[model samples]
Target chain A: MKLYALNMIQPVGEKPPPEALDKVMAELAEVRRDLESQEAWVFGRPLHGPEASTVVRLRDDEVIATDGPWTEGKEFIGGIIIIEVEDLDAALQVAARYTRVTGLPMEVRPFQGLI
Target chain B: MSVLVRVFGDVDVAEEAVQDAFAEAVRRWPADGAPPSPAGWIITTARNKAIDRLRREAAREGKQAQAVLVNVAEPVEEGVVRDERLRLMFTCCHPALALQARVALTLRLLGGLTTAEIARAFLVPEATMAQRLVRAKGKIRDAGIPYRVPEEADLPGRLTGVLAVIYLVFNQGYGGRDELAAEAIRLGRVLAELMADEPEVLGLLALMLLIESRKGARMRDGELILLADQDRALWDRGLVDEGQALVRRCLRRNRPGPYQIQAAINAVHGDAARAEETDWRQILQLYDQLMGVAPSPVAALNRAVAVAEVEGVEEALAVVDGLDLGHYYLFHAIRADLLRRLGRREAAAAAYDEAIGRTENEAELAFLRRRRVSVCG
Candidate 1:
């Protein structure tokens, strides 16, 4: 088995309808619970909006600080889930299902080195 | 390698253990006599080696995945050892890797050639080949590419990649080295046996055999001899018979593919007892079928040659002129011949000059230069 990071990407200002959001949230909760019970879920968490993000860099031994995500991309990483799976096909299926439940586009990338 | 990789689920560890097992075999086999099943012995030893290595690593990392190796007690079957080779072939031909990387990895993993040897064969630096292997291996591991042969639905697409790699190996040897050609024939035999029902596999085997059958007369005195000028008696009749037989078998399947069509075309050439006896009309039809199924400029170029034989030089010249293969040396060489046959001496000489400029092989350059001399003179 290998661990994959499924990063949820969401538009910065777009929000679903109140009822749609509620239903999606409920489905997300159920799916997460099922994954946790199956021991496939390793860790997961939602993130604050990109406005609250901070960037820190070191240049020529001088500290520099900035606000916002790394780039000015319209969509930002809203949340992420880590799961242990057998192969790329399994990881892709999990990512697709997660997107269907949460209404968020997901990017799945495998972690290097075995657990 | 495939069995060990599946068991360990890690390319690096599987490779190391297989190497170690081979080393142990070299040390122990002479004294104890060869085992009844050498492959079975190696797999068992490699599996034990992997388990031991994982056990030691688990003590340090304490990971759950590493701990799972403690329960690895699957029986090693001889059938699995055979199937695993097919699995390895599929993995090497995975579409995710670049074509060059796929070919290099296949040569290294399945063909059992060292990186330096592969580099030499492909005319690249050893370091570049080494890096390509490392990168391809890393990608396979990080992407979690499964080490299993594709399902029935994906076989056609995946098999194309495998066949291309095999033919590339054959061509690499066809350039000069007999050893590489012989190895490719052996691999082709294995593929033909394993994929007995595939018409294209049979086609590829037949094509390789037909072309390689002329190895003895393909060259003389370090110079490439044109097919028309080569001594017919030097051709290997045994190989020609076998190749023609395979082509006949492919025709019976009634499922024509590019490779099968090409093999059928070569079979037509093999049927000729002398150069003047060649049935160009039959060859031209096969090329037309080949162009329909696998249309490429190279195939078109070859079709033009056959057209010249069946049709006149003017007709063939018209067909060749329509093709977009200005950079191909054979295109220029063939054009030169067509121009010469049409009595356009200066144009033929110019085309031969272009052919000599575009080619890399010393023998080919020599042949082209000789053609240029005759055309200019």
Candidate 2:
């Protein structure tokens, strides 16, 4: 099975002014609805504003939590869905929808059963 | 040599025979006893299997030609095995193939990587990569791309494709998602070793070593670490030193290529005690030269980052503002950081969101999610 990460696009700030959120997610939800038939999608939840998100890492045997997304950037993942497509073209079709909906990008990956 | 010898010595058939021999060994070796020379036993078994297969195939055709050829088939030839493999590589790297297919074919054959492994590395589906491989191999067969080292006249033109194949393999490995990263490195190492006299090959290896040195430190568990966050103590000093030496050698040769220039940039990153100490000016110069040789928007964006360090955030933003890299995560990420530094928290956060949206990496997404929290706070 192919694995794709369908990243939800959102603008920066604690909240994407509810209007911006609605505009973007309307597009995303359309993509979400369209892609469900193409492949299997994992958990479906948009990212909370950065404040609500936590960065977690494992050090030695413990878990470390930090502010949020490690890189310094503005656009962040609002939510995610994983799809198992048959081929890269099919996967690209899924990613293309997100871009079509929001004029943004989503990375497509095929899951290797083993790392 | 009879046509029989050619078929028996063919790469695909030989590979199948060898696989069968190895499988038979695994079954019979335990039942009997380990041969005095296991490798020798396997080679012999495979050759004999090929001869038998040829005979059987001929027998099925009810032709004595097969029996005649088998009788004429000489004892196992030692050098032919390596020749076939080399022949395969030569065809796989033929200039006729697309850049992606070259690396895909190399990884599939030379590196012993499965289609699934290469697909994972490049972040594409397995079936697509598998088709790409098939198409590449078929192209080799259709165009009659020769299975020999390219002629000296063709070398200059084809060298770029060869180096590209090496770099492509390296990137697949470096891309972090695919297991082909190690395979890419192996391909690079082999290319370097094959062209040891050529300094650029060494530069490619050094460059890969330099960047790969920090691979472990780049990610802590599954979370990403910016250059500054990476612990210097965890860095591989051995790789750093070796890569530096190699880059120095390549620069001295004065016949620099993109790989050599890229190696120089990585060398600076590898040698810096801290991100602050990084020789951004030298990197910028290399990027300038790199852009001339291989112009890419990503390179320009990177150069913009260097400009930011030397000049200011506004200047850097302006450099990338009109560029066309809408779907790239790094461009958005860099823009977000620059805006954030300028205290345009709202805009910066928005850019960050754009970066996160572009990328599928969980660690990067998680990091972006948390950054939004801090920006609004």
CAPRI band for model 1: medium
Tell me how far candidate 2 lies from the true structure as C-alpha RMSD in angstroms.
19.4
- The lDDT of each candidate is 0.87, 0.72
Residue A102 in candidate 1 has what lDDT? 78
- Tens-digit lDDT track for model 2 on B1-377? 11212454334555566678878998998899998766556667776787777678778988666446544334445455555544566667775578789888877777877789778777799999978987876655433345655657556556667767877777756656445666666767766766677777787888888888888788776777888789988888988898899998897889888788888988888878988898888888888999998788988998898888877889998998968998999899888888888889999888888898898877777777777678876
Identify the runs in model 1 with alpha carbons over 4 angstroms from their true place.
A1-56, A59-86, A89-108, A113-115, B53-75
Interface RMSD of 1: 0.8
True contacts kept of each: 0.81, 0.00
* Two-chain complex of model 2, DockQ on C-alpha atoms against the true structure: 0.01
Highest TM-score among the candidates is held by which one? 1
lDDT of 1 by residue, B1-377 (tens): 88887777677788888888899999999999989889888888888887888777887788656658544666678888878888888888887689999888888888878889999988899999999999999888888877877778668988998999889889989889776788788878878987899999999999999999899998888789988888989999999999999999999999999999998988888888899999999999999999899999999999999999998889999999999999999999999999999999999999999998898888898888988999787
Q: What range of 10 consecutive residues in model 1 chain B has the weakest lDDT sum?
A: B64-73
